[model samples]
Target: MTHNLQNDLLVRAAFSRPTERPPVWMMRQAGRFMKEYWDIKNRYSFLEMCKTPEIAADVTMLPVDLLGIDAAILFSDILVTAEAMGGQLSFEQGVGPQFANPVRSRSDAEALQTDVVHKLQYVAEAIKVVKHRLQGSIPLIGFAGAPFTVLSYLVEGGSSKDFKRTKLLLHNEPELAHLILQKIADVTVDYLNMQISAGVDALQLFDSWALALAWDDYEAFAHRYNAYIFSKIDRGGVPVISFCKGSSVFAPLMATAKPDVVSVDWNADLRHVKDGLPEGIAVQGNLDPFVLYADKKVIKAKILQLFERMRGTDGFIFNLGHGIMPDIPFDNVRYAIDIVKEFRY
Candidate 1:
């Protein structure tokens, strides 16, 4: 239980502490892009892998061993919390995640349990397994979906293009939307704290659907709850990252939420977004995930460009703007990581 971290670069950079180099870790570092991951996936269903502590721990360590990254994020789905809150979740081969009972009404929303510690204890168990295996070599990141993103799934039933169902509910039943968001915020705080208690070094709140809303609507819904979660969580001095995919326009607003770091999506300029945020907050990414598909020369150039943009900054963590694409060549990812590790800024 004595965590003498061999490499605390990620943790230090997250806190805006000066470091020799920027730490690097991808979002979906442990996913289908690696043959080793598929080797495990072939043996267990996704849900099974998540629920089983040993399997989840192994998956969490994959990127660190295979790709030489600075962090190991726990291998668990954001929706597991939703399922634990009584949404009945399942996965399909190509269709992605499906919910047996989507929350579309006040009655449906009322059914979600607020006490998440007991229901989602598997995640905390998995975190302990990861920490023991990791031996404090590098940080372990734990995360959950921001309330609005989780609400998108609950209202739309799955992935959405327009989020029409969710938007309609937010507009037509404002009180209902608030009720659901409040419940989710409460659960998110407890669930995240449970992960921290089990020994995660940092946490990230992923609002993948934040881009769907205009700034005004985002403030009304996503920002409000994100701030609430930040306010309530017991962080114990660990850094909390607020990440809103494709919403660089809200960097200043995201800063207002007061997370230690704000992750930028690929569509934004890394330098521009960082400059926009307040002085104390650190910035995470902006490299397009598809940049890996290009040749080494291009990848190196792209990596160098990002480094140069963030050259003088204290808290830069090199990463793809989003998760690594499944088709991205494994060798290319390795080369990219090396480029990042080798660069001197």
Candidate 2:
């Protein structure tokens, strides 16, 4: 399962090894902005693109080939785990993802399929396909939604701004919340291990909604399950990245969860976060994604500014604070990557 990669900078940086420069990759690097992605998107539904190994692998490789990023993340959605847990998932035109049957009651929580690895075989197959296509060019990253974030979607049924229903359930039925999180955590551990066995070089746990909780709430609901999931996964030396947006306040708490890397959002200062986190945990991200909208000169300067802040810091991976927007010009992304590649330590 070893990949003889030419560019192991991302892998080395993830493991906190010294590198010539910070290896660059974006969170949603493979989607929307590229014409090739739309070419395929036009032909298939979102689920079809994710389920089809060939298409998924092709999409995953697009960023590496087109943008020259140092890593390839599997082109899949976090809700796929929800789907595997026997929830019905669909993507609408204006709306992103909707769950037909959400986990609202204790019965709903118990109904979630505990045996998830077999059902998610397509993801592993897609990873294998992506690995074959990558030809050891760079490391492939596998990821899943953190248990709490997955629980939020499962409870709220879709994307939520305030997560009112989710928090209500957490407050009203705390035991039910933990029960569902435990179920999801069990599945997450099995699911991530499967991805690793399929040959991915690194993994990330995306707790996109962790910011919704207060400190005590986050510690009880989010951090507890995240820490358990991280504990159960056997990384086998591959770095695990824990990312949560709007999470500056929880950086110190998150560091204790022990992900090999902590990906910060745009608002958090990279140096400040780096100093707070324990030694040996690498830092990734902090660049504003909107900065890509600027002209090439501005983009280059902004990239340099981030690098300047991160200068002499080991275990740094250059990435946007969050996913790239759909309407962003493709060339701007290309130019940004070029800037990161050209910059020296």
Candidate 3:
């Protein structure tokens, strides 16, 4: 599935190999910040956009074409796996994703399906299309939600502020929580492997809600399942990235999973985090997304400051701490990418 890539900076940097400068890409680089995205988004339901290969490839190409990023991440939602696993998933304008039949009791947990890769074939189709569109110009990153985060969505029925139901399930029914987590981990392993088979250049596992758990709970529920998926996947030299909101605190634990890169939030110093990580494990991100809202001068200064701190470091990629917000100025995002691309080590 390899193609002659014009820019292998991302893959090289992911393996901690030397590069001309740190490769630049953001978490949600292809998302709503652009009028071009909304032009297409307005015509389809969010899921419609994700499931259609042509539309998904179109959306996946926006950042690469418009922003000149180092990579293109597949345009899809994490909870699509949940829906394929028998959750009645839905999204509202402001309510986000909701599962009509959430896993509540032991029976509910047991009823969830594990043989779901067949149902997710559209993702593979979309990947093929994205790769064709990329034409070996850059890499395409495939991703899935990490087990605990996907489980939280299934148990809570949607996004939550406190994750009270999820935590209570863990505290009140430890075995049940383990059962659900195992199912998710199994699906994730197969799902990621499917993406690799379909020809993604790299993978990223998003544990968007791992920060919600206490230390012990996180180890038991989050870390173990992520590690299991990492162990089972057939990566075939494709780099895998492990990311969570609390990576600044849990990166050491994350590195133990053997991910090629660990993406951290903006709370920690990028250089300090990189210094702490074991050698050969690359570090991506730690910039505040809100910084894009500042003036171009401020954005340039912040980008330069991060680059200065990371100078002489290998395996570093410049990116925002998290996904871009929808309302961020499109010009500002373009400007930010320009700033990162212009810098040199």
Candidate 4:
């Protein structure tokens, strides 16, 4: 594990340096595919793994040992923030995260607790554990759900193709929504600051549903809070990467959010993102996740095309536009990593 920290693939990629090889890692790379993760899941339910630092740290490193990616995102879910917030949350295998007690009113929102740092201290401790074990060999990334995204889950009470209730609440009851968003945003900023203090080298903010909002609504609702989270981080040296799903619309806001690195999702055009983004910030992805299922030859060809498209760019990190699905072939996943590693610039 004794490797050059300064030259670490993830570190170089964050700085937009032409790495010795293009740094490669996957979203959800530390997840179910790994036997260690499955073993942990079998031993403990979802919440237990998150709360148990030793177990979470163990899960976080499995992908690091297996795929040997440039970095490790702390093993946890974004919804964990909501659960810590006094929102009652539980997961159903196929259904995803669900909130039993949601905030529909300003009073309900106010009644819920904020400043969950003390509760989420486990996440910070897990990072500490992973860092101690990695011995500074690999960068460990800290992440949190962006405020609006978190608030969306809380208000909608779970996942939704459309956040009509959330949007209606935002529109019909502006003060209540504002109060909720404001509190969540404040917590998010504090939480991320706390994570950085916990020893994470880089950070990512996930706005998984930002695209569903209208353009102006996004500016008023989501963008500012995401900006606030970044503002509290150590920008002087540390790296900050923002990964908002449905990135085409949000690409413009990436400039304002002030992430040192901005990740592009499959729905966005790489060229357009490159064109509109602010200078000095690195770009992280755009490959469709389903590409992992394409035949190996076709997958390799696309990877070569990605390299050519991304070649000579000072600040580019090759990654799937989203996390790899569980059904993907390990061989294809390995092949994709090889292609990313061969991208000299």
Task: Point out where model 2 deviates above 4 Å.
Answer: 1-3
- Assess each prediction's global lDDT (C-alpha) against the native: 0.90, 0.90, 0.93, 0.81
Question: Model 4: how far is 94 from its true place, Å?
Answer: 1.7
lDDT of 3 by residue, 98-207 (tens): 99999999999989999999999999999999988888899999999999999999999999999999999999999999999999999999999999999999999999
What would you estimate as the lDDT of candidate 4? 0.81
RMSD of each: 1.2, 1.0, 0.9, 2.2
Name the lDDT value of residue 328 in candidate 3. Answer: 93
Query: Model 4: runs farther than 4 Å from truth?
Result: 1-7
RMSD of 1: 1.2
Q: What is candidate 2's lDDT per residue for 1-345, written digit by digit as tens? A: 455689999888988899999999998998888899999999999999999999998899888888889999999999899899998999986798999998888888888989978989999999999988888888999999998899989988999999999999989999999999999899999999999999999999999989889999999999998899899988886789999985677888988998989999999888888878888889999789999998888888888888888888899999888999998999999999888888888
Where model 3 places Cα greater than 4 Å from the true spot, the runs are 1-3
Question: Model 1: what TM-score?
Answer: 0.98
Residue 337 in model 2: shift from native, Å?
0.3
Ranking by lDDT: 3, 2, 1, 4
Model 3, C-alpha of 151: deviation from truth (Å): 0.6
- Lowest lDDT sum, 10 consecutive residues, model 4, at 1-10
Best by lDDT: 3
lDDT of 4 at 209: 86
Pairs in clash, predicted candidate 1:
none
lDDT of 2 at 95: 98
TM-score, every prediction: 0.98, 0.98, 0.99, 0.95
lDDT of 4 at 175: 80
